[model samples]
Target: MTVRPILETHSPSSDPSWWGAILLGAVFILAGLIVLGDVVAATVISAFIIGIVLLVAGASEVFQSFSAPHWRGFLLRLLVGLLYAVCGLMLVSNPAAASVALTLVFALALIASGVVRIVQAVEYWQWFGWLLLVSGIVGIAAGLVILSKWPVSGLWVLGLVVGIDLLLHGFWWITLGAGLRRDNRAITA
Candidate 1:
């Protein structure tokens, strides 16, 4: 049996992209730290940003609806666009409320996903089922914790999650950069 590299043809030699990854990792880590420092503010800001994005997406969809060839499709797209726009306006108008609502939705999603994963884990128990089980348990625990705190949790959970995500993402990028650098060295030598 033989194992093949996924990108056998691509060489890491002479590529300076690793440095960029490292730089990005550092920035992400810094941003994570900053967000963690003021989670409430971070949550509000994130909600506002999401609202703006939704608004833009809604506008784009509405514009595209005009190009739809059929009346049914046009009506569907227009309706979706209007929904998005309305939701975006609501979010923008009250980011704190939006954060609370979104947090509740997130908690529910986590619990539902955890339950689904647990069921799937039973089926896959013979092969890496333990990992899935652990993940599912963690998800359930996290959701429970968030729900226990409810509205209070909403203010900080999103920001804390974002910060943690950024930190992990930074670490991943840094590790990737280091690996690339090492591979480059090996290839050059």
Candidate 2:
């Protein structure tokens, strides 16, 4: 039996266009940081912003659902939109409560995302099951930690975490944006 080498093809050496993506990522990281800072400075302000965002998003969803061609899907979306609106209203009505609510929401989302990722990994790459499982476990652990520190933790830790995340995201975006710009130039060239 002869061992065969895996042959790979490479494009001619040219400037890689990944710079734009990097720059974009950096910008996002920076934006995340800014948002995190805002959250830290005033949780109320952050809550207000979140409320406004939710309101806008919910309204958009409702409008889209109404305009959708599929009535059944539209109805479902409308229900979701209503829920979003209610949550947004609650946040606005009592910004102080937003911290706890946000924490719970974040934890739930993390766990849900982790589960989805794990499932996808299991289906697509059995060999990667461990990776996905670990990710899911981490997400669940994080959620549990957040839940344990709710209220008081929601007030201080949440803001700090959000700020750090924002900072990281902004940096990521900036890097991605720059990379994209570079790639666009290279493509044009």
> Candidate 1 lDDT (Cα, whole model)?
0.76
Clashing pairs in 1: none
Candidate 1 runs further than 4 Å off: 1-13, 67-72, 105-144, 184-189
Please report the candidate that would top TM-score against the real structure. 1
Steric overlap count per candidate: 0, 46
Q: Model 2 — which ten-residue stretch has the worst lDDT?
A: 5-14
Candidate 2 C-alpha lDDT tens digits along 66-142:
89847678778998898888888888888777867777777677667667756754663433345445555666666
Off by over 4 Å in 2: 1-17, 36-38, 57-83, 112-141, 166-189
Instruction: Give per-residue CA lDDT, model 1, range 122-156, as digits (tens).
Output: 87564345545665676677778888899889888
**Per-candidate TM-score against the hidden true structure:** 0.67, 0.53
